[model samples]
Target: MDADHLLTRRTVLATATAGVAAGAFPQTSVARRLRREPFARAGTFASGVASGQPNQRGITLWTRLHDIGASERLGMEIARDPGFARVVHRETIRAAAVRDFTARTRVLTRRLDPGERYFYRFFTRTTQSPVGAFKTLRPPDSREPVRIGWFSCQRYEHGFFTPHAGLAAEEDLDLVVSLGDYLYEEDSPAKLAEREQSTGDPNGHVETLEQWRAKHRLYRSDASLQAMHAAHPVIAIWDDCEVEGNWAGEGPSSGPSPVGPRSVPFSVKQRNGFLTFFENMPQEPIGSERFRIYRRLRLGGLVDLFLLDTRKYRDPQPCEDATFEGDVPPCLDADRPGRKRVGPAQQRWLTAGLERAQATWKVLGNAQMMMALDIAPTRPVGYDSWDGYGAERRAILEQVRASGVENLVSIVGDVHTFFAGELHTTGRIGSPVVGTEFVGTSVSHDGIEVVGDEQQSALVTDRIVLSNPHLRYAKFGVRGYSVLEARPDELRVDFKGVRSVLAPTSETYLLKSFRVAAGTPRVRPA
Candidate 1:
């Protein structure tokens, strides 16, 4: 059977008893037999444990066993406290080679309470994995504040994940969001040289399934990244680097050719990327169809978080091929109707969700910048983002404006810079503001390289901000993450930057802060 199909079937079987009070467990006899099997102590759970997809009732937990042979039965436990003295749920699960020795299970028991913290761990009879913790979401009617930390574009070879460590230490964060580029598929020669010197892993472009899996493993080897996963539940989404740099789900070239062999078809590479992503991340499997990552999560009366898969369902970039990056001459194709950033189904889903959402803040977990970036008057750059699909972006903004969806904020990644701007109905400045967009800087990717030297990049960013009136802030050559706190009356975002990612340990400081009032869609410096 196809791997996607197999995982889908497994997910169906696992979630069959979702409505029951306790987790769906094996039969009594089979459970007893599995429990009696001798523990395997040959391998280690080096990847650490992760929890995600949190709901009012439960969340998904994930971990991988390294250096293990064949399948092994493991014990799983969830508790109300770190001590495990008050265990709420326990089950015997298998870590199978078919799934890359990774075990991901959903613990959705009625016994679990909402707005509560829980600890979990995976173990064999002998070895125990690190204990992980997560907090279940509050009920939709509750009026509590929600604190979220988000980061993106962490190419392992670029620098140490110091920002991730900082986020891991944030005890007040209710959730951590990974807005894509979780791991880069290819690294530049300079970065590769650095990796060879540092980690001694010469692994370059990842194309095949095993290569993709290896890349994920290599990234997961980062203790800081693993610490962040162990500390908080993550809501992860992918950007271009997870597969090819500028890939579109349906397009010629599917963005640029990777650094290694092009023998593998783009479709195969895409499938392999998605397979490894699902296998490694703490997300539930989507049944058989092309894996859909766009979904909404409600956080009491404060937030309705819409996580979008902008790459998978988007149409090709306008005027030029989808693989093309940077500024291009103005063309008619960009304004043409029916070009989609998020396809029709997703558009409808997002529109309906925004229109019907009663939460105080409607947050879009966008993978790329949605604000227009004009280097010159009326000339937009970066077609890889929403600037490529002008008509669709306008449509969505217009719908939001028409429906009176207030307190709209989009938290974005990719582009490797920090940006705070207003989402206008039209791409041009002075148009009616429909929402606010806060684009976070990369975890380690160099934003200065995207432009030129430090001075040149600063000049270019200044020009961009001056050219676009709606843009409130633009800072290039920074490496860090952003924290968003949503309350009933306002939404506040703080861009946190690290002193250096080259050093294993660095201090973080607030680069900037912005806030949006309840009914206002404009961004203002806080």
Candidate 2:
């Protein structure tokens, strides 16, 4: 946190408590009385509508009112056609400040047939939002091809969200998977200026409930991110940035020299991060908790999507809490019997799910990469990734091989680099290979562009290939997302790249692609 932006702990708590009151959308009585003025003067529905947590029986609908009066009751109208000729589902949703003036309602669609397209919009008094259309997932055991687009790591200040805009316009995807780093919590003059943010006061790293809510609002204000949500059903999982960078269980975020790897206990920030995350996302209450984003999605039994939560419940990094650039001798604590990336309970659950899965393809939606970056024996690699937890990685790969579980692929984000390769049990390239891994580049983060230790493209490619035999593709310099097209027999991934995120009007094209066949642990150009 910037010294200038730091707030007293008492002030932070009081501000959050005072701002949130049931039915009172505004904290100030005067604003509460004048809330209707903003709502009436302009359209109340500014963030638009989105649908997620899609299952065979129902889907969750979400919307945020740019302005709301005291004790306002919003109307939700759903239909099969865009013109609203036939309204199928109608309900009243309460828009209160307790939920940050957002409505997340789940509608059970057993009344309607499955796989039908539906148009939905929200109503406030006399205003009506634009209708959003979404297609339902196909029936069970249908063997229908599933088109999924997964993206992550969009720093609001680094560049435009044009990739999201392009994905919304061009990709006909069944599910939009956001693998985390949805928003950066820190804001600097350089970044703020680039994003055209006019914060007269010095903005610091976010650390409170109010700050979290404000950050969510600012990100949703972007048209590209809003359009992407409105266009498809998004299945999302958070990485470190949502709360803090490289944050493990009950840990602080990683930052520069001042903000050390293990800086402070951010229990408050973590809770607030999750609170705003649920308030913004369309997930229903899983179990009795407001948080907990790790859940599985079934796509007609053709694919079983296991969304894992890597940041929440886990031991700290094994190598003395190091950053992405930090490395040292392996620590004994890494394999201290119970150290885990997904933890013990999640590991058991995932193991059981994979063993009993009946789907043709089992897909793991992960936050960090699985590839063991084979550095020299004298050099230490990044401690914030699976490379830090070598034992856990070996266990999962061994589980996959032991179960004879064919057709497994892990789609990951974070690290802001692209990697298409085979998963080896040990860090050595000669180790036994198990499954396939495709790590997508960041949407707006800085791209490594330079492969290997050298700038020469040919030498870098040759070095990467020779150093890690399991890796078939490697590129660090690019800003884009990945497309995963899954069939019964094979899974194809396209690493789509944009020329520059700094350019608002940049176009997206395929940079590279690879295919992994069923029962084979190899990556080849499609």
Tell me how candidate 2 scores on lDDT: 0.73
Question: Per-residue CA lDDT of candidate 2, range 411-440, in tens?
Answer: 999878788888776544677777788999
Evaluate all candidate structures by whole-model CA lDDT and list the values in order.
0.81, 0.73
Candidate 1 on 332-411: residue-level lDDT in tens?
A: 67768888778998899999999999999999999987788777776776576788788888999899899989888999
Q: Tell me the deviation in Å of residue 291 in model 2.
A: 2.0
Q: Which candidate is the best by lDDT?
A: 1
C-alpha TM-scores of all predictions: 0.89, 0.85
Report lDDT (Cα) of residue 216, candidate 1: 85
Highest TM-score: give the candidate number.
1
TM-score of 1: 0.89
Model 2, residue 111: what's the lDDT?
54
